[model samples]
Target: MFLALKEVGQSKIRYTLISLIMIAILFLVFFITGLANGLSFADSSSLQNLKTDYIVTNEEADGAVINSTLSEDQLKTIEEQLNQQSTPFSLTISAVEDKQGKEVNVAYFSVDTEKYSDIEIIEGKNISELTGNEVIINENIKNHGYELNDIIVDKISDTPMKIAGFSKNQTYTFLPVIYADFDLGMSNIYGDEPSYNAVLYTGEKVDISGFDTLTKNEAVKSIPGYTETQGSLMMMVVFLFIISAFVSTVFFFIITIQKLNQFGILKAVGADTKYIAKSIFIQVILLTTIGLSLSGLAIYGITQLLPGEMPFKISPTLMLGTAGLFLVLNLLGSLLSVYKVAKIDALEAIGRVE
Candidate 1:
């Protein structure tokens, strides 16, 4: 360790350049990770906030809540079979014009407010308090210049709905969500059919002959594009990890070759191979540690400077997991150089028997 530190100190510029390169690579990984997480949250935050354990959808829908359709009779049967209260829910993609007459895309969700009551109202009352054409919208609506008591008109039906309140962090399918009374939302979308897209329930698993029961995790995974988007980002992350490992291996190998004569002298003077290997390992670990630390700090700082509208989030568990993977892979890559050091012959390296 002492010798490694001394050597690094002597080659400050080279080590610094390597650390900078590593920092750049890791920063990209962390930043992209944040983006992946943010996109996922945007895709499913509305459902996650429901805090329900199970979602009942039509078996034919194949785990897709958006594709599921449940009639009042079907919902009642499921409720009775499970002996639990259930909330009938439906969603539609619609455009709403803000107070300034600017149109914005929104996912309109309708549910029995009394049964669900899952949304957290940031500034005003819940959707249950909404009387005729009133609705509760996500706080993101405020960014578009709509606020409490503001009227937003549905582009399709030309129906003007009053924003009775605002909730925080409610999004669906990567769009801001508007929560409205089931009757009003159903009337606008279904014209008084008294039907819903799915049912939300809490408790142990319940098996209905014609319906599929999905956990929260399974439900999230079923969202369209959720799997594909996350999968692509993860592949990119893995590639970057492999590239970093390759860079570290090649860099360390070259450094070791350059110092072969010094290693040979140390070995001739009674230093064992194990001692030299330890020094190399310590150097690799130290470099990786410093690079990871700086990259983590950079991610935090950069995210703080980003605009609120940017869908970027940081999960501690994910960040730590990624960092741990990088460390392990880098160590493995550094082992190649360590192996070369072990093969260094004292006499040959010193030109005494070459």
Candidate 2:
């Protein structure tokens, strides 16, 4: 370790160059990872945040909540069969016009406020406390200049709804959500008759005939583009990991070759192969630690500076997992260099330059 630090200090520019390269590669990995997580959250947060365990949909809808419909008879049968209280909610895509006449797309979630209101209000009154056309919405809609007590017109129904409050992290299909009273939403947005898109079930198992049950996570896949988008971004992240390993391996392998003569001299002076290998290990550890730390900080700053509309989230689990994976890859990549150092013949390597 002492010798490794001495060498790095003496060859500051070389070590710095390699460290910079590591930082660049790691920065790209972290940024893309955060972007992927953010987009996934944006795509399914509305359902993810729901407290229910499974969603009961009409078997004919093929597990799609948007396409599912449960009549009053089916709802009663399901409640009785399961012998539990189930909350019926409806979700649909709609648009609202801001005061400036600009249209912003939104997912309208109509929940029975008295039965199940899982939305966490960040501002204003709770939806349960409101009536008629009053609604609570995702706080992100504030970005469109709509705020507490502001009125936004529903594009489809042409009904002006008051923004009673705002909730955080509520979205579906990459569109911010608006939570409305179940009965009122049916009258204004859906229709005059009472109907629901799906029922929220919190039971362990559901086997009712004529109905398909999906876990909350499984239901997110039913959202359009959720699977395809996640798969594509995840593939890019996997390739980046491969590239990091390759870059680290080649860089250290070449460096090891250049230091053969020095390694031979050290061995001739009584240093063992284990001692030499430890030096390479120490150097790799030091470089990776410094590089990943700096990259994490840089990515955090970039996420903060990014536009609010741009979906980007950074979580501690992701950062730690990424850093841990990177460190392991770099350590494994340096094994070739360690093996080269271990096999150096003191006499042959020393005489090569002569």
List, residue by residue over 208-323, the lDDT tens digit for candidate 1.
88999998788888988889999998788778888888988899999999999999999999998899999988988899999999999999899889988889998788889989
Give the runs in model 2 whose Cα sits over 4 Å from its true position: 186-192, 352-354
lDDT agreement with native, every candidate: 0.85, 0.86
Q: What shift in Å separates residue 311 of candidate 2 from its native position after superposition?
A: 0.5
- Output candidate 1 Cα RMSD: 1.9
TM-score of every model? Answer: 0.93, 0.95
Q: What C-alpha RMSD separates each model from the true structure?
A: 1.9, 1.8
Model 2 local distance difference test score: 0.86
Worst 10 residues of 1 by lDDT: 186-195
